[model samples]
Target: MKLGNIEEDSKMSPAFFLQRLPAQRRSALHDVINIRHAYHKLCEICEEVSEFYGFTIFTDMAHNGILVTLVSYFLLVFFIGMIKVDLISCISYGVIIVWFAFQTTVLTSYVTRTIIQIEKTANVINKLIRQCAMNKKVEKELLNFRCELAFQKVKFTAWGVFSLDRSFLASSVYGSVHQRNLIYVKYIFFKILGLAPWKLNLVTKPSKNRTAKTIICKFSYLGLLYNVLLTTSVFLMTSYFCHQHNSVQAQVDSLVTPSTMMNLQYFAVILSSSVFLNYTCRQKDMIGILNEIIKIDKKLQKYAFNSAKNGNIIINLIFLGHLIICSTLICLQYFFLQSFWLAVLRCWPAFLYCWLIVQYTIMLDMMEKRFKFINLNIVKLGEIKVNSEGLEPVSATRISFLRESVLYDVVNIKDNYNKLCDICNDISDFYGLPFLKVMMYHGTSTILILYFMLVAYYESKEFHLLLFIKDVGFVLWMVFQIIILTTFVNKTIDKIAGTTATYLIILIQFRASTPN
Candidate 1:
């Protein structure tokens, strides 16, 4: 029964015995050794990736350097032109450049992090390749590792405009061009939004405990404050900008200047860029959680399988919504704005930004709900007792195995949950300041657009119905975008409250059931 004792009695080294063993035994030994080696290689890769990802000084400096240079150049030109007639315009341009530089810095930081992630993955595969050359016996196993690493490469975008890699850039452009097909767009619309009736089918059953409701309400209100502050900030920005100019016409023209329009569009694009970074980060986070879930000793693959299916559905829905919003906004701009070509040039950036924002928010909402759903299911698993419910009689050995499996599953679930929490914290760290900037800048843009409309309405000697509708529609679109944006954070908070409650209940029961 003891292989070590048998080998010792044979007076042979382990490798010598391995070579002399029966063919089947030798094959099994070879396999075990290979698996152990592969596992060690994978762990080393993970450690290297994690270490490189944390040391982002190089990426940080590169990204920051570009922005700082641009800001310096703009500042120098602005102050040089101060003695000229466009004093106020120069100040406005300077402010815009400063804001743009700040946003670019934040966006670059995120891109740098993603690049490091990709680089480390490549490093892992290359290391495996090198090992394969040294160990011809494990070549097949190393090849498999290479394939898996290739499959797991993080495909990220830079500012949602172009792919991080040149190859993906072509594919992204094709996808955007594909949206021009009205029939395809319509088909997708029906596929996602048309499936609304089935949403109830997918919903989790109501929880028996209602304590989560009160907590959810509290968190919802807290999230609502963000929406309120954003709206209030818009009004404050409107007043400040309006007071800068003496005449109403001057205010309107100043806000609508070619430079102002371009800056606003650029700001929207940058704000939308946050969505690409955030969405990619969340996905990477989910992959980490899923990996841990699959590592549990229990038959956890079934649960992980279901979770992955649900997550994919959520991601698909978000993509569908993004496409729909993009098409709608583009059409809206053409219908409402001046010359078709000019309108497309000026308005496309903001519209594209809106689409990305909506996509990001929807992804946020569904991801939080998915996390809550998975946690609640885990809690239910914890509630099952070996002897508390009716069941077929089993041998003591079987029952003991069952009990151990249940405990192991629960412990693994708790560990994975903690890892998921860390992912949330990472998201917050990445999004916090950039989100604030977006809300503040977007709020100001919305107010300026509204004020521009008001100034137009009063200054016109004759009533223009078409002009009024366009103005009102623009304002309405901005308001609607903000409402949708705020709902994502609110829903995420509510789901978090429910998840926390479920976790607490499971912990309490687990403690009570533990023997002294």
Candidate 2:
């Protein structure tokens, strides 16, 4: 039942493991595919030994982290299922109503705390450990212990910290990305089905003949598609809710006023906006991961192919294109929230969406690692195809190309940092072990506490929140209209692709036409 032995670990290895392993202990380990490429990227600089042998901190976790998160999520869901609506209302009236301000404060504090944890944890572990071993007699155990220490910190830094804390009352960043994609995908096809929007500028910048037509025919369609998808979904949903509220108000007009209907609508919009915005930074991280990976691959080509030395390029691919996408989501939410209070409540569902995404990331990270091992093993055992593509087989042309990529003709680690330093590629400059320990130990637990505070605050004043929503429904309803109109109008190809003069002209004409 207990998997504590190399025998079990060997069982986890791919068929190719027997041939590829330099050390038996490092062979035959469990695989987690989610972010293995990212690990491969990071391990380049993350490795501590003079040997340049890289092992991913995440890939080696046997994927227990994801399992743990899932268990936590299910429990949270179970508790929510037990909550009664009337009880929520009573609590909201008595306690939560009094604490809305405090909840806001807590949310602010939590987001800040999580960011700090990330900043602190992304350290150059290999450099630090080599520093420790420079003068002292290096024991094998010490090496292992030091490596584990640095890894423990990464276990809870940046995204890890974000995932843990952000999941408290709402969902996870992962969930939000999925939702945005789903919502946008559905909307685009149903209403604006033509071509996908060209997100980048190279395609849009005028160059050859008929640039306007090119922009319209080639790229505008994609933007329009996304716009149509989002607009249709938001407007349709808003219209449905507005219709339902109108019908209910007809029956209860004597009891509640139109102003009351508007307030409740506002509250719901707040919830939606919050959910949408959290995905912003997530998109940035995705890009970071990809950039790191590309760099690592280049590094490997330069260092390993020419010489017989085993070079592990430190490319943390997990930080790739996803970051940009997530950041956009965050910005999207921010704009949505700025429009109304109803958008705030949407944070919870967004958080839920995030939690689910984190779960998959963990799973995929595991799977990628396993497959990497299988690839390595296949190459080692000569099981690879004669045309084996990715396995970096040694050849003259490959070695020559690799040499060109390196900063210098030299490839020795002894000279580079004068210590066991790996190239750590990240946006942040500050990273260390103390920061990591703090993150790993505090990241999840801290957010959990904050989430609890949020829940408790809400639970206490359920009635007031209901009343608040009831009072501001129409103002909130305006948010739905805003998202629909702005998304559709701003994204319009002809309008967006217009020259600066066009915008000025439109602005002037509109003002001149006004009754004021």
Candidate 3:
């Protein structure tokens, strides 16, 4: 139990080190430390996955060679599609081939690994729960740890289009296949008619000139035609070569199988349940603790009310931001693509983005509201009035009761504060990295879309008003989405800071009011 021995043992055994700490510190750190330990295990698994997938270079040449071959196989098909026997095609089908091939492998890997990781974590939690059946304290801690695990569940989504986890891939497979086929068919139809599949008429301004319309139409048709040819060639190459190569087929089939699809669905359900359990339990836990903190005296009620009033605007702002973002995403998807199914296909990323924004906002809002609620409780306890000397018998009894409440509140406040701190730490640990990844994906996708818009503008002879409107709306929607996302994180940080400051102020006031 000595500090020196504890320090020495910490490197080997954190749980042992924790046991030797004082009771309050032990309770506060136990869940936080254990959750972090689980997170480290996940990080280790990610590294191994990364190496296996050739994201990291191996010292072994043979392993590196295999990685190179896999990457080169896809790249070679794309490169071949780019060449038209004499010169490179203007349609840039190479990009499409590369995108699809890369997406196929990466998403497949992500889906498989994510499902396995979730299953492993779920198994671990179940085992821990069973082992701690008789120990309520340990069981409770394990439950919290499981929640933290679910919140930070492994996912691999590179940009909005390629992110495939078990749940997402399984659900989208049929629709995605149909959409892909539809797009391919459309490209073929346009090609047969000698029209461009990629070209859409854009207008810089209104024009009634017959010659201008003809010239603009011709330019669009040619541009679209070039793109169509390249993209179709790439798709043809991938399908044909995939059939010829057993290795490629095996790699693709592993992710597309019925068994793999089922696993992904199961993963989604388990992770979703864990996330719900954690948030629901955390809310109830906080409310229960607040009740304990408020029980000491009736005087603290008014202070709690005032604190809640102060936070009303923040809660409203959070909700308002979510509303705006959700609307923008829906409009972006629906407005540009006239076809319901095509819009759904193209705007799925925007939809997913909106969902994440709402999910994170709701969770953060709950935490922020609870933080303010607890502050109000603290204020109520702070304002309790002591009975004055020479008061009547009833008044004296009331004052005595109020004074006794102060002692109880003071003793328990520190413990409650520690618990609140644990709640905050656990949540941030659970959601921080995932949020960061989401933000990065949004930013990158926005940039890529903008690049395509610029290319379209440059290539078009004249802008069609309707096309121009759609482009502007799409860009604006992306910007708004980014704004909403960043604001979500910023608001949470602000709430955490405000809660911390409130804790200090209450502690100082309580100590000053005491007769010590």
| Top model number, lDDT | 1
Off by over 4 Å in 3: 1-338, 385-400, 410-416, 456-460, 503-516
Q: Which ten residues in a row have the lowest lDDT in candidate 1?
A: 194-203
What is the Å distance of residue 330 in model 2 from its true position? 16
The ten-residue window of minimal lDDT in model 2 covers 307-316
Candidates ranked, most accurate by TM-score first: 1, 3, 2
The clash count for each model shown is 0, 104, 10
By TM-score, is 2 or 3 better? 3
> Can you give the lDDT of residue 452 in candidate 3?
52
Model 2: per-residue Cα lDDT over 302-359, one tens digit each: 3332111121111112222233333333334334344232232223223222332322
The predictions' CA RMSDs to the true structure, in order, are: 19.2, 24.3, 26.3
- Tell me how many residue pairs clash in candidate 2: 104
Q: What local lDDT does model 3 show for residue 247?
A: 37
Q: What is the C-alpha lDDT of each candidate?
A: 0.50, 0.34, 0.48
Q: How much does candidate 2 score in TM-score?
A: 0.23
TM-score for each predicted model, relative to the true structure = 0.42, 0.23, 0.36
lDDT of 3 by residue, 99-152 (tens): 655755566675787668665865676665554222345456667767766666
Q: 1 or 2: which has the higher lDDT?
A: 1
Clashing pairs in 3: 166-264, 196-224, 196-225, 202-463, 202-464, 203-463, 203-464, 300-380, 300-381, 304-376
